[model samples]
Target: MSNDVAILGVGMHKWGKWGKNFVEYGVKACLDALKDAGIEWTDVDFVSGADTVRNGYPGYVAGATFAQALGWTGARVASSYAACASGATGMNAARAQILAGMADVALVIGADTTPKGFLAPTSGDRPDDPDWLRFRLLGAANPTYFGLYARRRMELYGATEKDFAKVKVKNAAHGFKNSYARYNKKFTEEEVLNSPMVSDPLRLFEICATSDGAAAVVLTSMDFARKHTANPIKIAAISTVTPTYPNTVIEMPNFATDSSAVVGLPDAPFRDSIAKAAYEEAGLGPEDLDLAEVYDLSSALELDWYENIGLCKEGEAERLLNDGETTMGGRVPVNPSGGLACFGEAVPAQAISQVCELTWQLRGAAGERQVKGAKVGLTVNQGLFGHGSSVIVTK
Candidate 1:
């Protein structure tokens, strides 16, 4: 009767602009996950894939595409697309199947081959599409929103550009030894501060870049997992909650916040609610987390996650970063895999990649970036629109 699903294996292709087809990257990661799980492609009864919008037709039907690429093993296939939360969506699908007795074993995969420069909206003059309207009218690219948040934090919480720089500095060092990280170079606060500003208060080093990468995981029912391994990292909860009405905070691809004129605010903010639901489902809390991997789209955003994920209270994230509580060997290391700061954004693959890092950490195999005695980890990321992605994993 447990809601937990066992994570038998996790894998990722090195993050970079390899320029090869996304399918190749996905296939490699899938194969690696299968090998790690000690299972065969034919052994999987379900395939759940996160869709990549940038890729063509095959990307749309990623589940079937990967199934075909892996030789059509008669596995049931499903694909999910929720912008940055795509991987979590696919993961939710796989977990549902396993928990519902539809399948004993499932494979979840995501990959992306990104385009250069700012991630713009898809072509055409569609006014109805808020994403397109944002680009066409206000030119409010992703960084623009990032900048707005940074500036707001600076104003309300006294967070300086230096505090933001320290986030990049810390994450850079964490990722320095990470082989899967795209930017494995250590960075100094000076270097971060000196870097050109992409968004006000956000330097080039602070903002994550677009990259090509893939990540995958093998999941099974607890009964199936017990047959294979004595101990397995269990996915305790997966939260893909949608934003409540009157989502006051402005989200990405949208120009304005929801008007609170008629409806009252929800009891909790959207971002805070994301992890809250997962925590409730897992019977855990922020205090129970040994470590966390949060979406760091911008260096300043990492601090925001500290509060949103309950690492600290609002306006206290800068204090946590400055106090070293969120660093390696600290109370609760955040982004031990270097986060998006080191890996950049691979869209559909990002959330799954976060789970992969947690899987390694829980197994005590994360090498230099490992958090000592790490038993439980959480990942929180938000995709465009109101997609909320957060997963709780425990050893």
Candidate 2:
């Protein structure tokens, strides 16, 4: 498909446990994006915001709250929440508005201060919330699910604990150069293996921590973009896909996977399904990609995406890592901006931040972490359950 929308600007508040209000981060990121675009808040035709549930009332109506903060000009407003997919969902909302002629320019925002330790349900009571039930009843913390994936890899693919630790080591090395990363310290493979285990099979470094951060982007119609500057990176496709019925694999906040007793399992897992949609929409295969930024909640999960995103054949993910094919000098570098290993899991902010990294890399502006001559990049953010977002961009 042809590109219709241009990412004129991208910005973010550094990811860390700053112990501050979510609004502060959002406002900071918005201002930076607006500045980068050379477009004032008053000039924006619309503003889209991602919900940060921990903030109570403000989160429920994030679009207006952010609008008011930036001196409201009656820009069209939209809000969305989908576990970790909030940022990309907001981007999609903004992009759709522009493509539909509802607006010429839009600012997409996703900001949050993640809770300490495990993220619990927003409401105090109510078994209706799957997050609450998973914590209260099953004691299935997020790490437990990460453990399951890791153990499964060990059993099926012969992936060892050292392989998992290698992911932490690689990401930490990448994080050391990223100023926005929450943890900039380089991790040694030995340190990762020696660190205390969180959930069995997954060590401390193997899991991402929670952090406070915000990221925003200015997306505009291609016509408006040409008037502003030359050589703009365009958003080629945005894929938000859910699993087909009978999703057999276990996911976060869910007690159990869907039963295949009645219906046989689908050919592809939800993660691969998400990437497949993106590739189809962009009219490009995994071989065409210059790089990818994936949700690496765990080391094993990072490897899973190597196969899930079709960078390699199923079960051949180990070869990619072993051959240094996923590194900066590799055929398709993954997570050159450090990713969650350094950025942490800021539910709302992370998805947009991944795109920000993509924008910089595509523009040849990502200084130390630059993917040489990068022309195409994709960001894959999978939320709890079936909510998944994948964005494909090109220069």
Candidate 3:
């Protein structure tokens, strides 16, 4: 694939309950991205949207809805749905179009108004639906899966709840500077440890909150970017990969592991595979990354990402955390944008928001929270039900 896509601009609607419709949030973010790119909405040749589950039938055709809301410029429109990975997938589509010469400039948008309480499966008890089955049979809220992973890490690597708390502490400090973060308040280790338990070994503070937010990006061909700005941060790779079978790594909302009963799972877990694909495509390794923005739905998940992204060896993530290696001003920092631990889960908007943070860091515009002298950045996230996303950005 051509590494010729450049991010001209990125924007986000301030996260939190604004009591507005998803379309309004999306339009605001879209317009902000256009303004940031110094381009007009009419100048975009195509638009891609990350689909959100609507209260009614209106959610399915997100691209058309967003386009119409923006005055129907009749730009080539596409909508993508990949659960939490929807935003990254939307970005992947926009970049592909730019690389294929299908469109010189494209708009990528994702926004969501999430439901309260546990993120329930779609209504109706369809036995065939794994999401429903997991909920019904296992009573596994998302936190249960997070608990399983955290427990596994404890068993395999001896990572303590304190290590996980460090993640929350670090990210919360960073989030304190992020105006868009839903939870701007910092948490102490004692506070994190004392928070109400959502699942075994994971407390409410340890888990990311469901948030309402929107994010958008303006992508263009490298040629177009060069004409518009001298130093546009370019997207080196976008990995929208899936898992291999016998995926023994137990994922969310699944009652049983991929039957090692049939075939042995690959040595690398599916999560690592996502980052590997992006690293391979970018012709760079994790060592080359100046910073990373990963999905930290739970604090334990952040530790897992440190190893999965090859920033550290297996079970060594805690050591890295203790060494302050993953914090800002440390070697090859991870989640300098505060991650979902601080930002919370905006679902469709989260992955795009990761890139938005990377763009700011690469442009040397991230005040205070910036990773000093960052040249290459990576964003990694896994969507439930087998969707994976990883993107590499370089100055």
Candidate 4:
């Protein structure tokens, strides 16, 4: 397919615990995007929404939900559900539709009203579903899985609690600069280290919270974009991949992992494979990237992504962080928009917001947090159940 689909506009509703309808958040963000694109609702040929499961039946019919909220211009509609990667999955749907000549322009949206604490399993009696069984039997929340990874890093990679604390400090600094961020207060290493521990190795400050937020983007074919604006940012590549067999990594809400002693592990791990696909499609590598926004579920997870996304050698992530490279103005800055640490896991809306940050940075409109001369940006996030996403955007 062509690599010239352009993002005409990006918008978001302020992320927080707003006790309002998800429709309100979604429509506001959509209208903001439409206004930014200088297009009317009637101009949109199609629309797509990232499905939310936390809400009631309306969550399931996300596309129709948003369309009805936005006054229904008889636009073709679609929806997708991919856990935390849901928004990116929806974005891929819109991009694919535009590339196929099915629509000249598309509006993509995602929003969620996060529950108080860890998200619980929605299944009633599905014993086979790992998510349901793990929580039911062990009461092991998502943070427990993050703790496991953090501990593993300490043992295997000589990472320290200080290393993890450093991440909270860095992300908070950037978050403080973003007006759309939910938690704008800056954090310190002492504060993060002294914070209560939710799990064995991970602390409260190092982990992200659940949030309510919404984001939307307007996309169009390269030809259509040319007539609208001269400096159109292109969606260069979108990678939505799944894991290979005998996946040895222990993911969230799962009892165990695949046995790899006999069958052996895949050539590339799940996270690595996700980013490799994007790089191959974009014909670029870490060296070419100006910045990246990754799924920083925990501070340690950000370090893991630094390696997974090829920012540095496998064992060099901690050094990368200690040397001040992952901060806002560093070489190949990561999470310049504060990431999940600032905005928390809004899930469906999170990935869409990542692209929004990239759009702003590329446009040189990210005041205070802008990475100077940013030309290419990448966003990497994964949902449970083998959903992986990596989208590359370029000016």
Candidate 5:
């Protein structure tokens, strides 16, 4: 199948605790996207949903649930569950249908009504469930994993707390201009440094908050897009990859590191592997991107993505950040929409939200947060429990 899918429309719900149901937010985003696409629900040929565990029993069957809420039009449906990468996985599935000629117009939706406080494990104390065991045994909350990565970067790349704080400062400044962001307030290095510690090496402001939001996108075949609109943003690649065996890295909510007990870990890091695949599929390199939106669950993680996505060499992320290269007007701007650091983490909705930002930027609709003259853009995120993500979009 041809690797060509046009992004016709994008929509999103503001990131915050709006005290609303996930399905309501999903419907709102869907309607907004359909309106933007100049199409109605009945015009959709397929629907793909990114599922959230907190959204009740119907969450698992997200596509059908959303379809029913939107008044079903007999559209083909699919639901994907990949933890944080759920939304990107849904895009991958929808793109497959479009490329295969199974569907010409597809709607992708992701929404989440997150629980307040630290995200807890699933109910019941089943030792078989790794999510439960990690919380029960180690009490190693998500921040703990972030701390591990932060510390590793400090040790390996000489990244300082100040360097990490700068990331928060830059993102917060950008968020202040983003109306949809959760914490649209600026912060200084001292403020970030003084914030309460959630885990060693990670302060409260350093970690992204759990947010409630929804995002949707309308995707169609390039041929269909050309007939509908003279200018359409295209998704050149969608990479839904998995980690290589012997993944020594201890990821979020995981009890133990992938055992190095067998053969050693793979030659390339798991995060970089995702980008490599996307680059191969799109036939483009990181140097080709005008801007990027990466998963910045923590200020430190953003730096990690800089290296993983090939924006800089290992140990050079902090230098990029320090030089103001990753900010809005700088070279190869990243997370121009303020990223998770400012918008907070919306779980299932985040990956889709990233694309929404990219769509606006590519369309020159992004106001204050625009990466000037952005043409080729990329969105990179990682899902827990073997789900990986990377999406490359070009004008």
Candidate 6:
């Protein structure tokens, strides 16, 4: 019972403020993926769509919506919503169907159309909703949370503003030639520091923007892959675990962490557990990774991902960045596709975009940003609430 699923093809609609219906972007990506896989739309028997709650009715029934848009042939459909982790959830669903012998070929897709400015909670007046309360009561938008994390790094790890700027500089350079990236121009440390400070120590350029984009992947069982392609990248693991009780970290849109008075701390923190679970499922470790594409909502957050994904020890992420170990041609190049730094946050589409980058890197087709000879790559992302996402892919 090998839990492997082949990634036959991956595709994306260029990330930007396209100002079009999300379904349009989704369909384009799906068509691109189908073409890349060298298969007809009829070949797909399952459709797993990452949902967008902000987009009204079509977004709610994303799986069926996409099926209809693609000229439906009665494919079984499922929709998933896990905030930013939506794409990974959809991918996992498709993989499960393939592994369960329910479907030989499947399409996993995500697309988003976001508004300008900081992402806020849904339109509501509910007093119990922490998402709305955070904005209403504390005025704590996303950048506020990013600021808190950046300040924590400075105070705890002796990281400086320059250290955070370096992350932007590095990623900007990596994505300079990425055709799909929205903000591809490279920046210098001085330019990053000179930008307006939106959230305390974090400059405006250090934060990821909200944009419109789409990404899609075609997946099949290992047996089907062997007949379709000579050497296809296989999904070694997909971890969408939730947090354990007494989660101490006060994450996004939450005012308080779980009280530790009743229950003791778990064996691992929520973030650490994300990649650890994936590694366990894949029987691999950080040492096995050739590269990684992590959710870098902010420049400082990228440093946190290094430790969370076992790339380096806790508090050593600054040193890893300064040492150039996490950059291209380094020990483990993280975010060679430039990450959120260049592409911005397209919500549901982002996690799928990360996997698309991994597939290209594994095939050594990632043009200028390619991590040389990359064989095994990992993608890690987290979203609102306890949603955790991580995927391991091997060539």
> Which residue ranges in model 1 land beyond 4 Å of their true spot?
none
> Which one wins by TM-score: 1 or 4?
1
By lDDT, the candidates rank as 1, 6, 4, 5, 2, 3
Runs with alpha carbons beyond 4 Å of true place in candidate 2: none
By the lDDT metric, which is better: model 2 or model 4? Answer: 4
On residues 1-395, what C-alpha lDDT tens digit does candidate 3 reach at each position?
Answer: 36759999999987886656888888999999999999999999999989888434445667788899998887999999998999989999998888878999999999888776678888886999988998888888899999989999999999898988889999999878898887788889999999988887998999988878999999999899899999889999999999888777788767777777657667677999999999999999998989999899999999999999999999899999999988888997888877887777778899999999999999999998988999999999998989999999998
lDDT tens string, model 5, 1-395?
26879999888888899878899989999999999888888989999999999878888888888999999889999999999999999999999999888999999999889878988878875899888888888888888899999999999989999999999999988878887888889999999999998877889999999999999999999998888789899998889999888777788767776777668779777899998889999999999999999999899999999999999999999999999999978999899889998888888889999999999999999997888899999999999887889999988
lDDT of 6: 0.94
Q: After superposition, how far is residue 1 of candidate 2 from its true place, in Å?
A: 3.8
Better of 5 and 6 by lDDT: 6
Q: Model 3's lDDT to the true fold?
A: 0.88
Against the true structure, candidate 3 reaches a TM-score of: 0.98
- Under the 3 Å rule for N, CA and C atoms, how many clashes does model 6 have? 0
Candidate 2: tens digits of C-alpha lDDT, residues 314-368: 7778778878888888889889999899888889888899999999999899999
Q: Where does candidate 2 clash, by residue pair?
A: none
- Local accuracy of candidate 1 as per-residue lDDT tens digits, 81-153: 9999999999999999999999999999999999988998889779999999998889899999899999999
Candidate 6 TM-score to native: 0.99
lDDT of 2: 0.89
TM-score for each prediction?
0.99, 0.98, 0.98, 0.98, 0.98, 0.99
Q: Please list the residue runs of candidate 6 whose C-alpha ends up more than 4 Å from where it truly belongs after superposition.
A: none
Residue 233, model 2, lDDT: 85
Model 2, residue 88: distance off in Å is 1.0
